[model samples]
Target chain A: MPAICFIFLPIKYYYVRTHDEGVAVNKLNKFPKMLTRMRDGFLLNIGFAVLSIAIFLVIWYGLSIFLDTAYLPTPVEVWDALVDSFNTPDPSLGVTMWDSIMASLKRFVIGFVLALAIAVPIGLIMGFSKFAGMIGKPIVEVFRPIPPIAWVPFLFVVTGMIWGPILAIFIGVLFPVLSNVIFGVKSVEPQLIDAARTQGASKSDLFAKVVFPYTIPYMMTGIRIGLGIGWMCIVAAEMIGARGGGVGIYILTQANIGRYDYMFAGMVVIAALGLLTVEAASYVERRVSKWMGA
Target chain B: MNRSVLITIIVAVLLIGAGGAYVLLSSDDDGENKTYDVRVGYLAGDLHQVARVVASDDDVNGGESLFKENGLNISTPFAAGYANGGSVMDAFAADDIDIGFLGSPPAILKSLNLKIDIIIVAMVNSEGSSVVVKDGIDNFTDLKGKTIATPGVSSIQHLFLLELAAANGMNVKLDGTDGDDDTVFYVQVAPKDMQAAMDTNQVQAAIAWEPYGSQMILSGAGELLLWSGDVWPDHPCCVIAVSRSFAETNPDTVEMFLKAFIQANEMIDGAFDAGSGETYDRIITLATEFSGTNETVVLSSMEHMDLDYQIGDNFETYLEDYTQSYIDLGLIPGSKLADRDYANVTEYVEDLVQVQYLEAVD
Candidate 1:
């Protein structure tokens, strides 16, 4: 899915920005050569994506045929399972893929929002003030390397099932965003700050216009990395005890019952969702970078 | 250009590829793959499977395990122990273990669905599970509109929960999304964590295999609502299974393993009097260590459970009923029986179980 995303999302996102939003690229109809050249490059990328996906499918099918074990289902079988998951409830899990995704997505969004709420402010302060950084650095370093899954048993008991999984995602997403925000603050351009001050800008005005705008792109980068880790944490956490249905729970149930095809289907859903989120972050990063004239 | 050399290379590649494919597709070895130990797998920290632990004891067996005593190599595979029966089945799916002790439902559910050809050789234990409810949960009806914990859909204890709910005339559902006020919803929580889950109010009740029920009761966290025997008397829980290829290739080894297992079961049975003799004290200590619980909990657990190795006439019939329950819950597809090429559940059970190992023990 990530490999295909390297091809597919560029075209999809480009179309969404140019055609749907009627953005500046559409207004540059006068620059047909540049636009046409951009389109051609994108078309080549899409072609490569299709070719690679086809090759991957062929190899998968051939391996399934050659190995001839129930462990590896053909790609077509996986696709069918994936399609069927959306339309019907899994016999073992008794939840459709849509239901599972919604529950996971709710946890992810809530967790992401919570991370942003706490991490951003802390990161800004730590980066801006030496004393704050001194106090926070030791705690961050101590907790950073401990895996999210190590906390599953403790979290489930303390926070209960619903919030336990959410907190896992929060833990996964917090550090990257926090660290990146710190890096972004520390790396803010001295020239930009100097220019803002020379223009008679107040401290608040300089921070809002110069420091914050520069950090948006970095925050988006952290968010992209955090999103991937969040998915992984949620899946691992849910495998133990997820009260309401989740994609991880769905996959685990299928695996427990020896339904490899259904398990692969759940996995494919996660891959696709993870790719969609990263691509969305990439899109936001692009827009923010352009707005900041990067 | 170089036709002869090219042909030779092609033949060599063909030979190597075919050899690799055969190795991968083949189910068992020729009794020559014994670099490690016997690679026995069991559910981690489960007291119901203490039979294996007893068999593995060097002290009891006088400087070697029972398997070693019977002239068979016994080794604990580093990755062999699993948290649950479903994981033991997964290890079987990967062809990682020669023998495993897991729930019969997973043994039935996975072997048929995943096409893993493991045959159940003997019974491990039965009636070793109970439903523990938090304070104020007096009866089954009090469980309405609440979330309960079980191992998972494929576990025998989960089926016990469903059957007990139905026997009391309550509606039960998995996924818990559209459940009404009278419906009981279930979540998957490992037995080791059930006491914590109940203590935190994460789950109102939990149905788990013993030492957990006994552990929860002894901890003063929950009260026992139903023993598995109360639902279905002496129903099968966990059973000993062997990979078909392993059994077929290493028949003598398999026979020795069973002999050692039977000896362990006999020893365990003799120790059932609890602290009356040295054997009883040893079993209590072993049970406490193997289950990661207290001596009090182990003694309490032993009272509520039976450790039987024999599979009599009624077991196969109960297996069919268990399969039907899985089918009814949509956990197992009705067509899976046909997929396995069995005419019905009866044929499936007959093929699934092989009593020859147990019968040939003497």
Candidate 2:
């Protein structure tokens, strides 16, 4: 028991020393680091963003005046529309702006999550094994270049209107996630694999511990990209194929009826939803990959 | 800078300079030869054959030279073709189009929304729309629980479908759900793709304006479940709509344009009355040329449509009823000036139909 303690004590001491150094350094850096972050982080960036948006609004207002067409509804008019849409339901569309946004978000989440579930495993298999990669390469290469809208008719025929847009979005998101996961797996450090093997780690254990951790940052990147593409795809698919209520459908329907103000409001809602989702994805990445020091 | 970079910069500058010179010279030419540009929006279907004949200078009645004869130096009219009435209304709102030949519901919707202040100039065609279904589906009740496609929610055909369903006591569900046992699911499809959707069994029935409905019947993809005229006899389908701004700014031009269109409509009527031979052949040729459809489809579609240019009392009643249907559907607000009620809605519809131009032409 003493001998065992002696052996374990050195290892424990080494860990403690490294951990203490890390903690001390973090403590020493915290104040200046926070100051630097404050100089460049949320408040400052938000201020700049607000300024940028103000400039955009000014330009838009100027153009609206210059054009003087009903199509170019002013910011004030759009605001009125946005307010009205939120307050009262559009009888034609059968829903308020809030309902449309919620419906769109629900479809987006289902499609995005479905894409991730299917793509991640296939990407992992392709990345970790040469045989799988060889088989998947041609299939991915072929389908990756096809635009999501091209699948609308086929999806509509098979799944009907309700699921067609979601499936279209899933297809749009799948390729980006798959490609990035494959890249992350293929780019895993050779030395790390050798080290794990030298320590008598099994193939499954190496994949579970090393490959997964290494691939997570890349997977997050893929997810971020997939999410953007998925948002665009959801809008287009819904515009073309959705029979029910969605933000894209609302925009299209409004435009069809010459309600440009409502169309612009719907567009603003889509942009805000997209920005929030991307930020959510980034937040998840930061939380999950904190050990990578991102 | 490196020699290669310097060379590249010089080449880029020369290219941009050449392109700029070309654009400047071309714009100067355009400015010098500026003709009265009347951008007209019309549907890509046989309903707008009169407008097409006037624009294309192939009027069988020899009305092509009428623009110059009226002291208007109009060039070949710019045709802004759209797939449906809704898009034509959109173009009118955007000021991309000054005149439109579109369906009644979209025209009325736009006027009610104050999107485009348009005057209903003339009737383009009537009774050209139909509800077509797969061969085995015989009646409106048989369409229950089956999917049906229409051009849009605010389309005249859609309104017709709703009325038909209501008459037959069938529930029409627009929500994206599969309808219940007594409900018919309604999907909005572009008129161009309605036949394809029907062919693929994606939709059991399609309610669309001609020549799509006619095309479906000609192709044997579907049979006519009900003609719109059979539902509402001589129901107003398409109307000639002119921007109020255009009419106010250029009343003579609008009058001249309407005169030419009315003449073409007369020619079409004369040919239909004659019913065969050279006059009818010429009308079919003009329609086929403008609509980008084949001759057989054009001929068959014309059989279902009455190319009447007059907007009579029947038109006013039709417009009022249609406006009330849209108001009840919660499509357009009930009224712009008063409370959301039938009287107010009728008042609003009255304001929308400006028939002084049509009357003056008459």
Among all candidates shown, the one with the greatest lDDT: 1
Name the candidate that leads on TM-score.
Answer: 1
TM-score of each: 0.88, 0.78
Residue-level error in angstroms, candidate 1, position B54: 0.5
Which lDDT tens digits does candidate 2 get at residues A210-291?
8988899889988988888888988888876666668988888787766778989998888888888888888898887896
Q: What's the TM-score, to 2 decimals, of chain B in model 2?
A: 0.82
**Per-prediction TM-score, chain B alone:** 0.87, 0.82
Model 1 segments more than 4 A misplaced: A1-40, A198-200, B1-37
**Backbone clashes in model 2, listed as residue pairs:** none
Query: What does DockQ give for each predicted structure?
Result: 0.49, 0.29
Fold similarity of candidate 1's chain A to the true chain A, as a TM-score: 0.84
Off by over 4 Å in 2: A1-37, A40-89, A96-106, A125-146, A150-159, A200-208, B1-36, B46-80, B135-137, B141-145, B166-171, B177-182, B270-294, B338-362
